[model samples]
Target: MTSVWIMLVKKSRAILGFAAISIVAASCGTNAPQDTWQPKGPNSKIIDDLQRPVFAVAGIIGLIVAVAVIYTLIKYRDRGQPIPEQTHGKPALEITLTIIPALILAVVAVFTFGAIFKLAKTDDTEMIINVTGQQWWWEYDYPTQNEFGITQPIISSGQLVMPVGTKVLLRETSRDVIHSYWIPALNGKRDAVPGRVQTLRLEADAPGIYAGQCTEFCGLSHANMRMEAVALSKADFAKWVANQQAAYVAPAKDSLAQQGEEVFLNQCVRCHQVNGLMRADGTPAIAAPDENVWSGSAPNLTHLMSRNTFAGASFDLLSKQCRDEVWNAPSDVVGTKYLAGVTEECLNQKDLRSWLRNAPAMLPMYANATQLKATGGKYRGMPYLALTEDDISKLVAYLLTLK
Candidate 1:
């Protein structure tokens, strides 16, 4: 009997050791872009600071409890002995346990309250950007700010761009189902509720990319609803604003890209907007997503190539080499590499072509005619356009010229 008990205890410890090793290994992921511990801004730092000590306290308490339980079980083992101490009441012991926990909690509450207020402070905001969440993507609209040379509104999707070291206030709201905006490196999660506007403060300590995702389970493809924050130097951000506001340069007359533009007007203009596109009748081209999509909007692809990712940042626009060149570039040159945009030589033709071929096939979305019943003859996502091979080629060409 003693040998059997020893064997069981050894096996239990071995299993527990394996689990502990596995957990530690998993937590040490080398490419954890969404790592909460690796905070890059003051707001996130506050969260990280609070979390570390709280986690320590919890771990210590858990360890103490486990040790006490094990010690008590061993020291009071039956061992063929008679039961002892029928009475259970112990006022002094109960009181000590209660007071100790209360004191610990009181200390934690003081720091937690201070951190909440610090994170909520927004009186010193240097910029304001409106962020709207839809079914599976985030849309950012930079309101005109004379200080940044942004004379006109700039709309972008998938990627939120801001200047490094500047306090950016995001006015968040949802267009359809409830969603959440979170960039772990910059700040905490903030829900984007419909009919109500919420604000989240964000600031990046350096120029780089930070990964994020919609935390709330809004609908299908919630896991794919990802976003990225790109922090650029003030000068680079000014240049980006200028590029976004610059007049759209028409594709060369009668070229392949021009033909692509024609195809775009015939097919994509219904839902996608390409700023500065003019109709043959000299009318400004506009998109009417409200009539087509239930969400009432689609990603604005005016400067498509300027961004590295597309389709809710779920697909890469640049090839691996090109993407690495931009993402891994030094802080000073990252802006220049990003501004270069997608060129023919650097485009990730596989994903881009596949996306243009059939959007619903690549990403789960309610684009089928049958699925439209719930949305009142409207799409919850992009429907198949059924473009020919020639059409896809032309469309790709035209989209590349957006930047």
Candidate 2:
């Protein structure tokens, strides 16, 4: 029995040694990628700065605790001697411990309050972008575009484009439930409550595309709700604004696109709006009627092809190879070329075809019309629009011309 016990101890030590080696190997693995803490905007900078002091304080506290534990383990260890005397209390030691932690906590509170106010300040904002959150999509409206020569409000979806180095204020709110807007590399998150207007400040130091997802769990498709902020140089942003402001072009005469336009008016016009298309009142229907969407309205797809991604930035605007080719380029080259907007070459024909064929099947949403009826004709998200193959082809052809 003694020999068996000795063998078990030897086996345990061997296993412990192997585990230690594996841990060392994992820590120094050559294949491990370096962490990329990319900071694109001002809010990220503030967060990073605040985190540094907190981490420093935590490190100091951890080191002190570790040293004290090691000292106690060694000093109080048994050495085949008499047991040490039991003390009632050490008042001075207890006071030191309590006071030290209280002082540290007070310092932390001061730093926290300063950061909170700094992040929430929005007094010097140059522009205000009204951001509306819906079930699984985002709407961006330039409310004061009239001063910039735009006759009406410029609205778009999926991507938020901002001029780099500008302090832009975001007035965010939700249509239904609560939603939170977050773009990690660019800024901190802010909640969009249904009845409350929350202001968020955002500024990108340089031109780049930063990705984010909805941090609030609104519903089933909450995980799929994503967004991107495209930070462009002032000149490039101006050019984009001009392109977006351009009047919508009609489909060519005697083309299948013309028939598709008729189909769109018959079926889709109720929910969507294409500029230059006239309503029954003979006025150009540039905006979706306010009552259409459960939110304010669906996105204006007039410049749909101008943005690279769509469906709330849930799908890529370009193919994988195309995105990589653009993203892997040098920084200066990448910023100008890789804005999340559609180009003539990178359009996803297959996905777009499928989306038009059956949008609900392509992207899961609360869009089943029959199921909606079961719930007393109430649905929060987009509903399915049954369309024939011929209708889908015509729709795709028409959408292609949007570019």
Report every candidate's CA lDDT: 0.89, 0.74
Worst 10 residues of 1 by lDDT: 22-31
- Report the lDDT tens digits of candidate 2 across residue range 111-155: 888888988888888878899998888989887554344456778
Q: Name the lDDT of candidate 1.
A: 0.89
Residue 1 displacement (Å), model 2? 19
lDDT by residue (tens digit), candidate 1, 200-315: 99999888889999999988889899999999999888888888898899999888899999999998999899888999899999999999999999999898988889987888
- Report the Cα lDDT for candidate 2: 0.74
Candidate 1 stretches greater than 4 Å from native: 1-29
Which candidate leads the pack in lDDT?
Answer: 1
After superposition, the stretches of candidate 2 with alpha carbons farther than 4 Å from their true spots are 1-37, 70-84, 146-151, 279-293, 326-331, 334-341, 373-376
Q: What are the clashing pairs of model 2? A: 307-341, 307-342, 308-340, 308-341, 308-342
TM-score per candidate:
0.95, 0.83
